[model samples]
Target: MKLATQAIRHVDLFAGIGGLRRAFDAVGSHCTFSSEWDGFSQQTYEANFRDNRKVDGRDLRDVQAGEIDDHDILLAGFPCQPFSIAGVSKKNSLGRDHGFADLTQGTLFFDVVRILKRWRPAGFLLENVKNLKSHDGGRTFEVIRRTLEEDLGYELHYRVINALHYLPQNRERIVIVGFKEPTSFSWDRLVLPPIGQTKMSSILHPEDGSEDPEGEYTLGPRAEVNSKYTLSDKLWNYLQGYAEKHRAAGNGFGYGLVGPDDTCRTLSARYYKDGSEILVKQDGRRNPRRLTPRECARLMGYDDTFRIPVSDTQAYKQFGNSVAVPVFEEVARIMLPEIERIKKSKPQTLQAVA
Candidate 1:
């Protein structure tokens, strides 16, 4: 069956493992360009999206802003390190500057802005941690929002959503969307599909008796068991304290020792450091281990067809660096219907399909 030509084109920035790419790919959006600085992510993106194979690990600053050609949309999951918890911790008492210009993300956004000025794509999608709204006293986020709306004259819409709404993962992110015309799209009316009911059992593959697909996640160690790792007083106390604090406020921040028949939490880049954030509980097991990078991939809604050609270390980094693909796909679906309505209302032109 032939697919309809994309009504819009997109370019991905910080295209880690092409998570943003995969989402658009699923929605019939064509990628006109892609850029990533990490070698491993570049490799994985190339293996999966052959058309984006030319993307090099070039510093975005080096790319002349006006060099990018005309495209329909731009997807930029810029570096979140500048606004993440880790970033704040690093900046705290580090005796370093972290304003919009001094931080890493500050610079990346500039590149994106430059590209926006040059390419002037009809729309743009940006992803970042929810904390961005509060980062650096909120100045960092202010600069970003202003650049796109006030400075660039875009109709901006943003939302803070959790991945659990679309997948089995408990993750939160802020997605910023901008259109050339604010009235061009109504962000508020964009409803989503049901966050289907699922269980940990579905995420977990069969025990020794079953075979996973050749390119699927390795089934060597579903989880690890160790007394020292599992029976630590520090972790237990932390979890206990977290639960108490949240309970006091009528919220929940405690550990979730889930089985395969449960939904998971947001996977972090720091997950490689320790899986303490979210550990899976197996029946009759003395210890619980953190979910593997592959599990993280599934939690992020990446299909097995999406190649993780990079090493485990690289895989974790890319996954941490990625946007939830399913989220983007849903956005595109909602936007597509509206775009088609616009197309039907007017005399059709090749540029409309371009």
Candidate 2:
């Protein structure tokens, strides 16, 4: 797909392994700045992209808005831990606040707001978990909407897009797109591919002689899935017992078993602890295996060329925390023309800044 002919400079914030960066790169945008603090993730990001200048390995909170480079578009997935359903539940169980109530991570959105207010980029794209809309009984989303539309005067549009329509995983995330001035920005333009078109087979390792070997992930010249990926007998039995207990308690906690034809559940950061959410079905034994880090990369819509410079644990977390690339790629495709249009000519109907 052809991207905008004109160059669009964008900064990557909370840039986990550069998933968003790859999406914008799919179109013809230049990443002028990037911020990611995690050492492992930064390692992977740096390994994948050679042009890693302006890549800050510090807390974005410490950086002032004036410190950021001027760009036509701002792209941020922002930390979703404070607003995500799992995050909220985990915090609530621990008797802690969530959403905008949590001071540390929750208020990071304000930083995005801070930068938006300073540079006033022609357009921006923000992504988060699907639960962000209903977090804090809709108050969280309300504040976000008001901040962009009322306070900063940006034309905002958002929607919860499912990755099943474009990938083998059933991940859903809310993408918020905003234009500095009024323009034709519509969600209808992002035409999603048919659901179930892609299956586990697309991303899963065949374990046969079909793929190339990638160090320990795949074995020998045949490149079969490494035996290490298969769960041990003790852990497999424990997970089954735990699932049975939860089932008896009328709780929905269990390992997701999927074959080559089925779709997998959302990959999470905790996948490193236990690959319960998404376990590949195996024959002969009742046990299933965790997806290899390379497979996780493909599951996140990253191409084979993308390097996994980190450990398996960190790779799982990074890809789990990443946005589905194709989904965002299509979103970028639709947003590019609008971004280009807005950049070319200033809009007359600028919303009054509050």
Candidate 3:
């Protein structure tokens, strides 16, 4: 897993609960600076990391480029709302602009550009919704590509990878990898495990006395999923009726009721309000249930050792917003050699001048 003899230093921007950090760290990268503006997310990051490197609390826009410490790589998930399908549709319904036209969130990508322009880390890995390539009729991606390749002068490669290849969820995200200098890097290095090999049963809490009880996340001794996770009669019926109405109108909108053998729909931040997207099926005459926060953690490729020090609602939001960890792990594995090569070539380039 060690890509270099020395630890590869990295900075994390918009680090939600350190999902990307976990992947990079797995490849022996050392995180030097981490930024996450949300107080709750910051708390979770701090609780888990507990390191000497201070987590940056200020907004990324407010922090100047020089403030970020020099590092080998930059990792950012950034805000995806400007380009995500769900986010675009929601904004349109609200009569708001999206995809770099929205005054509020759409401009945050510029922050990443500014940092890259100034610091020019040896390499970077940026992630967002797959729809980013098509956002704003492809103009948004065009600008991003031009800025990174033409203006900033970096070698870029990208792919829209599906987490279903690794996890039991149909989450697709576009990953962008850039290098200060090109090396033998290719997407072919990523090897996806067979789909459907992992099932919902892997992450779902075994209510049948097979697991030990976790604090607050489970009930008495057997660690059965909390009864509160089960959908109420009213909500379940309402969702069924709503799905019927959508079906009548020839719409695909409906709750996702999945059993142990099935994969799940994309987990979203809205899962807190109503776990409609992925409801775990139950035995005869009983209500389906929402994933416990712990289960959600597993679904996102987090091990049980990862602490969830926030409320259930906040936990749901953080995990939902997080990149699939195993997906990033394979990405880091592939990007490591290129990142290492760029760093090694730097001193040689400078020594020629000296």
Query: Mind giving the per-residue lDDT tens digits that candidate 1 earns over 1-354?
Result: 112243666788888888887887677777877888878778888888877248857878877655554566788998777677766678766965554655455578888888887656667889888988888788878888888999988878888877776777777889888776534566566565556465555555444536453333443443232233343556656766877899999996666677766777667776665565677765675556555566667777886566777766677767866888778777776565544443345434424211
- 27-116 in candidate 2: lDDT tens per residue? 998898999988889899999989838369889899977777768889999999999889999999999998888998999999999888
TM-score of 1: 0.81
Clashes of each: 8, 0, 0
TM-score of each model, paired residue for residue: 0.81, 0.96, 0.96
Pick the winner on TM-score between candidates 1 and 3.
3
Local error of candidate 2 at residue 75 (angstroms): 0.5
Off by over 4 Å in 1: 1-7, 99-101, 193-196, 208-210, 213-256, 337-354
lDDT of 1: 0.69
lDDT of each: 0.69, 0.89, 0.89
> What's the ranking of the predictions by TM-score, best on top?
3, 2, 1
lDDT of 1 at 53: 45
Q: Candidate 2: lDDT of 77?
A: 95
Global local distance difference test of model 2: 0.89
